[model samples]
Target: MSAQPESVTTPARSWFDSEDAPGRRDLETCIHCGLCLTACPTYRELKIEPDSPRGRLYLMRGLNEGRIAPSDPLVEHLDNCLGCRACETVCPAGVPYGRLLEETRGQLDRRRATRETPMRALGRWTLRHVVPRRERMHVIADLLRLGQWSPIAALMRSDWARRLLPPFAIQGFAMTPPLEPRDARSLERVAPRLPAGARMEATEAALVFLPAGTAKTRVWFFTSCVMEVMFPRVNHEAVRLLVLAGCRVEVPRAQTCCGALHAHAGLRREARVLARTNVAAFADAGYDFVVHDSAGCGATLRECGHLLDDGPDAERAARFAAITRDLSQVLAAVGLPDAPASLRSPRDPSRPLRVAYHDPCHLAHGQGVRAEPRALLRRLPGADVVDLANADWCCGSAGVYNLTHPVMADAQLEKKLDTVERAAPDVVVASNPGCLLHMRRGAAARGLDVRMAHIAEVLGEAYPAPEMARAPAR
Candidate 1:
């Protein structure tokens, strides 16, 4: 990110010198188009240009040309952006807004390296230290899970607790779904997890799964770090569904976190390290595709080409990115073997399972994956995929955006929940973890009966996973 050993010549007057810096030509392509205005969640909420993609591009261009200097207001304006990439989706000129913004952030982080706010400092530490380490992340999750049921959780829920710690901390605690047991959440337990007729064989370094019949294709399952700890049920379902579709599913043992959170937070150095690790982990694994269920992680994995677009690893990164696909994309291509047929509305057996699918911004906007998920949802034996107003619109759960910019996050969340309530579906499904957790919290706070779930969970309902080995009773 520092561009210390760069190969390209830096512009004489430019403030950004990194190889990854926002390219001048990329900024000039914006055309000052307002087409992205309504699509932008922050601009829609604040009605300001600096907060919009066009305005931000102008600011980036100004800095790249040395027309302006780094300042607090500039960082605030850039920081307000959710980086959901909705702007890119609507831009006719095809401006890579997310990439440019990330590069610009890297430049600013260097300038303000010594001036991190308490909140920002904490975020940087967590992204750098905790997220990339599998064991540490699991430990933290286990602790949080314990706290969720303790008397302290009730105390934290009280109004007076806001005075003791950051409001975001309390809000995040309230938003977390109940954590699965640590024993059940382990990768060893999760990878071998299968449905009723499926079987698996464990090699020294990986687990190979065989479907109920002959395997159709080979896939390397990337179990996202957060998904495993927070939503292991969904991970199990993803593998179960994959095997059921007649694929030889392999779970690589050496893979690390996808680094989407790091890259989004502008910790590019850490992001690059994690990216290279993954590229090496799956090298020569012999798979038709590297598939994952979490949309955000899928976007990051696919963008490894750009994240590592320098040094000797560039070509390999490109190769890795090429084969990476979201869970829905692979399933859509391979097709589901059968729909469970028992997944119907509880209130009326004759009615199809009333469902609404909310598109995660990363899936819809980041990876250009919109239809695949919906198509899979439609294939459910009794499903009626309802029309969600602005289904592609972000649910204000843009990674850690809910914690970093809670006010704006809530503004967008309220509007999203409003639409969900209007649709009045029995359940709402999203592919990414953050959106599911955030929207689930909002639905519960409002006492809405609507259940928020991952697409895999709903898919699992249609095609259930294998029975689990029961944990001993206390």
Candidate 2:
């Protein structure tokens, strides 16, 4: 036989044994226009072609076509992605970059099931076991909360102690919100009071909450696992706002984590399991919409269809994804009662409370939510709503990306905090729990003297209920 070309000398052996492998259509959709380069956080940070979305697409295509084998360098390039999906927003060809990336990671994860590093193994285990379990997460939070109150927290804050700790450890410690007591964290305290003669079938169950007045919209509230423990008040305020908006909201007992963190970490089966659980939980709830306050959870909920497309719940998942709405989207659509006279800067009632809005990456790029949050903030009476520069940029809390890749995460965070300082708002609102945690810590480390809040908290401030303001504090 004549000498074969070098390209044809070896057989192309497939390595992606996972069913969710990134396919040709999504990979080939990238035009290599490089528009996504500037939009991607890693590419912008590294200024490297491989770290860019287009370059990553090429790598994914190579893996899919069996032209390249998974190696440490190749996996590192893929692992470095924040998975913020900012590239999807700017893509002209409408490549499903987020979906493709998740699927590609799924393939890699399956291949490395046996050869995983200790750190990666620990992360995967936690996502599989703990994150999907609400009670265990809260218990861990309680332990961490105890640590936060102990002298250890103060010691950790010291320059010497900080220097001793790894950057990720310090960052993780900084991101920990003051955990709430179970009582304060409970959604039961604020479940709406239904009127004398009115009741709904969904509210007949243990997890459902009712609105005081006529229900304008029926919704199932997805209390995110992270939001439940780290920022419970956001959930409370959000549920309160939903009630006040005439939403008969139900907190389903069966609903679990949205699986964004799981998917980002490449636990595809775990993500699907959680997706299936949610789809099943909300199936008979009879809600007009599935409302979520956390942007990360909201994005994951909106993608449940794609996540479960190959599974038995494919049709149900598609139906579930259709009704998912962000809290801001729902609030804007329904219109809140006027911001009360009490909603003003504590420093001086004469001056408007300056509020700045930071866009959460998943909400903006993942779900295309930008204007609604700004508009909702602007509508607050006596508040000066300000715009954040490059608001839609990822805040580097990309599903634990800050913990895994602290260097790039801190770089992105510094830039974000710089913008907040320039804006100098009394409060900067980011609608995702992860963004709230990450940026809040970043702002404090910079000594920026700013408050980080969820949009629900800001709006809840405006429309205070008897439940939130309870007797002593106010």
Candidate 3:
């Protein structure tokens, strides 16, 4: 890791030249109140000034003022940040730390001239090329599924064999849920099982579900790429729950990845490209809201307004941003039916289902959706909900933070799991795919006898199909 070239000719304008780069105002807005320190995960874990929000702002300011170049040390400090946006929730100064950090990263990316490290190059290739395209992701998922059934599955789980694999690959394998076949991933395949005679129409453009009764509202469900591939059951449950809540649901097939990962990784141009594609995907949806089950995807979808402000389709981006809502928010807003009798605890009908809610950082800090999910959960028949200590803390699942910064991620994860164990809830609910996957792997690795589900899945349990309702408990 070398310092940025000091002797190189300065650019004609400011060193931060990219459109994605933050202006002086954003940097100046950080009043250095130190209010964000307690809320910052990295600062708490490392107890270092450089890892704190204020310190990072100082580095950004120094670079902006030409007092320091983008040294490897500076870059390392920036990269360590989780981008969880927890600081924003408590910042009295309203400093856009997440945006500033991203913009600064984008600036460095634009200025860099050295070749990328092989691992970085590979990561970029997958993020840019594979993850965004559904067909490519499916092909990769199919391959992974094949590996899971083959001898490679043993190799992946073997401690000795894991030592032979790249760290990222091992981390990736650990995070991935067992893959299901393509047919099993389709929402159409489960249409027959949707509650209450709901009618569903599927096409390459979108999947539309008409409620059994008159629709109170209509929304387009923003299915995330990773969620679609790795956690289709969550998506399916989300649709069924939405339809049951008196809303017609449409899932636009043309919609692509929300580009949260790209933007977080400083691929600004690529993120903007995906934003434009999504704007067009739901161009004619004409729905009340654009709903997403994954907190990360919803937060990123809402960012289109800022990410594509300079593009020609800025209005479309604005439209997309305006309607984007997390699944909990939408459900809370639209209201849900009274919990059915069957929704009570299976072990003892006299007691409520013991559920602990893990607030995904993006939903809690990004979308300000702390209460919606809990409110929905409490409404479940005989639901005994418990508060997770530091529920709003990042579960070390800030997008790919667990994979890239595993050590810090594990440290935060240890704290979170400790809290989970203390609560001893039957099920832990998370709204983001990353958090669900990361926490699920952690819980399983420790051999904790607890079930992990997306908020949608937990809520969906209350609205099982008629046939399922009659079936005796196993």
Candidate 4:
């Protein structure tokens, strides 16, 4: 394939003019230590300076100085970056690489009216129209589910599948049952609630169960757009485990897509519009807290406030963001009251299942939620949590990077898969949907049997027998 075409627009006067204040500050903070170069997956894979964070920073500087146009090969190198922000973790100057990269990408999108190719256009169209629209995505997801059982599914088992229908095949393999529709009364009845005195005396509650008007204390679970349609079991188990932990859970009807896909893809206007809709949807839910299972959604929701320009909507966005928490962080803070008694002595006492935890770049580098998920995993009976080498390295699944930069993404993913395989773990647990999806595809491509699961699903397996009820709230 031809190299992506060079930019037609004139380069901005300076990085200062090209970027927002935060971007300029981050770019200025770069000490050029090259520490980030080693941690960057693309840099390591290609062994090219330009693919590294330091090299990309220089490119950004050049773009800002009008030394290179927005469509230059240098800019394309910047575009190929995974944006995993693993570089920021080790940056001695504490440069805000994540914010800087995002700002730069957003600015580039703004200046360029059209994409370079048809595939990019099609990808963006699907993400904006099909993925965000729950109905359309669900329809496609159902077809994928059926396809998994058909003879053509064997076609999906080949290397050609990776080249032909990569995204769909990946989704097909990770398929889980769709969420069960919940009514208002069932939500309240099944939700975990604080004891009357507990509610009155406590300064905080675990979560404000926002089941679409149902009284279930379990919560209003935001299964996420992709997780709901593709990997419902993760969200289902998350809800089941939370309810068992004495947290009321509800799946709020008002809860919608988290808009991370759109935001990351540079559809800022669409992202903000969705953010505003979500703000209004949950505005009066009267829940003490909002919990999300997917780390990607959790992080995006937490930053929804940033999506809005200055206005009342911006203030509301901030408020909504504050209440959202990741499932592991929330459960660890609150403590699970009714954890399975059997878990007191884990299942495989003789040889506790050796498991490796791949830290999703979003969870580790984006939200600083590194320890909580690990802590929760360690609590599982007979489970040995092994840390892979370079635990903070990106898995090359920075949102849709695998689709947009498949060659670079595959090289990075291959390295990650090698690390995990060498550890010889019985399973691999990752917190974010993107990580799980990307890792699973990589593992399958290599014919590896490392099981991939969300932290919530793993915890759910430990819930005591006589699974929790789904009663309507009184």
Candidate 5:
């Protein structure tokens, strides 16, 4: 008889085994093609092979094969990644880098022996308690608004403010006045259904618009925590525009924050709680679809269904996820409003304002929505929409990244600023709030006349308001 094949013993589990436990099909698909390396911001900055997507995959492989320990420097390289998901868009092998990194990070957090600390505790508390509660967040936002006009505002304006204050605080001043909260009756009265024979609403499922503070669209507005406390006009604009497109609008007061920040920061348990709360809040509304204007929130809600583990709630969670859509995607489906004849100009006419569009990572890379916003910008009168190099790159405001990894965050922001300066755009248009804040600070740091506005705000200016419907678009 031929000699029996040698028996092979399975290796003991390492810290990285948890990542493999979920199956590495996405990770194993990577062929080290180097395409993602070119797209990675961290790799571009460090020029270190180990920091690139391929490098990270190699390290993960080594750890799995028992060639490297979890405590190796390789772990630091993985931890340094912003989880921006930019690499995901460019990957030819279709690797799920974001999911892999998230799993890896989860493993890291669990394996670490460190006990609870004040900062970590504080972060958990704020994310769990403050962010999900609209009333509490509104109170804090009002306080910040008050501080903006107070003597403390002067302190906030100091050069050291950006360094000393939390990243959220640095960005909080951009919140505009809250929108007037409307009950369902008022929303129905203000934004009635369109006349018969208008563009047929998609019969697949009723599109539930969660207006994240823009009044442009007439669709059902969620009036989320931040939008209600801060950028109210955005939801108003969104509602107005939706109504213009012949959508049935509902302003549901029961809706709250989407819990994206909490989920991204490893507070998955808290995120699930918020998800359940939101699902219950909107459960009996009988809407066919759910939509969000904020890409960050929309993405979170879209994926929240997956976070529910083995329970009766999982089916309901999946149902909620099924209906979620980004506002841009919804608008793109509805088609753009007809640009008024007077608004059409042969050249930039209103002023010599050069506007640059920064594609928020959540909207562009995370959700693959790069064109609709740009198309909307192109229709604006006298708006010079210049495309900066690496326009789709993340601003390093990966949710709370600026707060937790300020140095790397600043480095990424500086690179972004350099690109913006080269393009010399007077105004920066970004889709997500995190990017807007980060870009605002970068511009302020350089004393550049580059103001930032949401895409909806910019579009709202191009369209005439309800009372001014007969007026020509500016």
Candidate 6:
């Protein structure tokens, strides 16, 4: 009988048996130093132990060791976290709070089969089916644009109509900017507007742009999902700035979404799938660095290697992550080109542009890119850049957190809006798409007149086509 296979006995499986469970070692790394408490937006607002980083680490430890159950209160505490990774920025012991929270949420998602509320179900379905695909995003953006431009928008904006919908849905619609007409949104249609001096070359079906002078470096642009659909203008401007800086910029249409939203929502499986797809898309494309304008997307792209560290695609993912760069970081490295003379004195020749810059949490904390954006902002001709207090604090967008947790998101948004109001900036610049959307909504809701724009948009304005500058003189 072969000794009955040695009568082997295996250990019983727990609810947290999945690979998504928090690493016990990473959890132990937290020294409960509390340095991250003040840096935490939720801790600063709620002033609670459970909401703080150290407190969350303790909860994670208890759950990992099976000392605690996945109770309603514990799950709520974890869900309340923005996953902005701001805690990672200040943790002296280098606790991997973001990874711990994400993995813990993944395990919680697997364990709680009965917890799927209608809203939550809808969110998951959309994330699984819609987000990673570029075409679906365009279709959704079109539908939204149609509603906004039609009488449907006014009807939905009414208080009674808004009450009938989910709060996040209402807030999301209110936050969106009017979309570009379909035909005008294509990159082909937009690129022709570049200055006469600009030169564009093609490589392996990717668009490469070089300044009038010799190219200093080559860069590949990671065109984001929402960026292409909703904010095509910003993408165009970013391209212009890169070409102006003597970069041989390449735009590979094969690139898709960075899967930041998937990771943030604890859909690690889906995130990994998208990460692999991105690896395949950019694998053969040759470039020194991959550039992204949105801070949230850039941060996630930089972590792709870590996301797929142990998988078959590990080496490729690591290489891709190594080359990813935020737009400001790359621009600052190559040197910020001088603004066109026309932009120098557009408002008042005597006074520089009174600009207030809001730091995106992902850029400031997640990627340590605080100095790069600020440096680029200051380089604009005649820009009197003023610092906003608590500028690095979360603007409450937190990648759809405003939709999921309106109350907490509002508190932070209101605080940020107040600071902008006091500064009285002619233009409030945000480097992340979510921050721009949230801040714009906050400013609009409060009847504030401050114009909000992406940092690239502001820089693009400074380097207008030569024809535009000569138009007035002619």
Model 5, 61-153: lDDT tens digits are: 665555667664766687678878889998988887765665565555555522455666787788878988876876776666577675777
* Clash number by candidate, in order: 1, 0, 1, 36, 28, 0
Tens digit per residue, CA lDDT, model 6, 146-250: 889768898879988777987878888898888988776666654566556777666676777767677788888888887888788788878888877888787
Q: What is the C-alpha lDDT of each candidate?
A: 0.85, 0.82, 0.85, 0.68, 0.66, 0.81
lDDT of 6: 0.81
lDDT of 4 by residue, 138-167 (tens): 677666666667575777666787677756
Q: Pairs clashing in candidate 1?
A: 195-466
- Candidate 5 ranges with C-alpha deviation above 4 Å: 1-8, 14-22, 59-69, 72-75, 110-118, 157-224, 282-288, 340-354, 381-383, 466-474
How well does each candidate superpose onto the true structure, as a TM-score? 0.93, 0.93, 0.93, 0.80, 0.78, 0.92
**Runs with alpha carbons beyond 4 Å of true place in candidate 2:** 1-13, 113-115, 158-166, 192-205, 466-474
- In model 3, the runs with Cα more than 4 Å from the true position are 1-13, 113-115, 342-350, 466-474
Better of 2 and 5 by lDDT: 2
Off by more than 4 A, model 4: 1-23, 113-115, 155-220, 341-350, 464-474
**Residue 212, candidate 3: C-alpha displacement in angstroms:** 1.7
Candidate 1 on 1-474: residue-level lDDT in tens? 565543346544877776578877898998876999888988988899999889888889988988787788888889899889999999999999998988888777756632578988898899888988889988999899888887989888887898887988998898887888888875456444565567888888888787876778999999999998898878877888888888888888889999998888887778889999999988874689999999999999998999888778988889899999999989999988777545677568788778998989989999999888888888788888999999988888899999988888888898999999999998898989999989988888888888887888788777644452232110
lDDT of 5: 0.66
Candidate 2 residue 65 Cα shift, in angstroms, is 1.5
Q: What is the lDDT of candidate 1?
A: 0.85
Candidate 1 global TM-score: 0.93
lDDT of 2 by residue, 68-170 (tens): 8888888888888988899999999999998888888887787673347767877888888898999899888888888798697988778998788766677
List of clashing residue pairs for candidate 3: 352-382
Question: Lowest summed lDDT over 10 consecutive residues: which window, candidate 4?
Answer: 194-203
Error of 4 at 404 (Å): 2.6
In what order do the candidates fall by lDDT, top score first?
1, 3, 2, 6, 4, 5
lDDT for 1 (candidate 3): 83
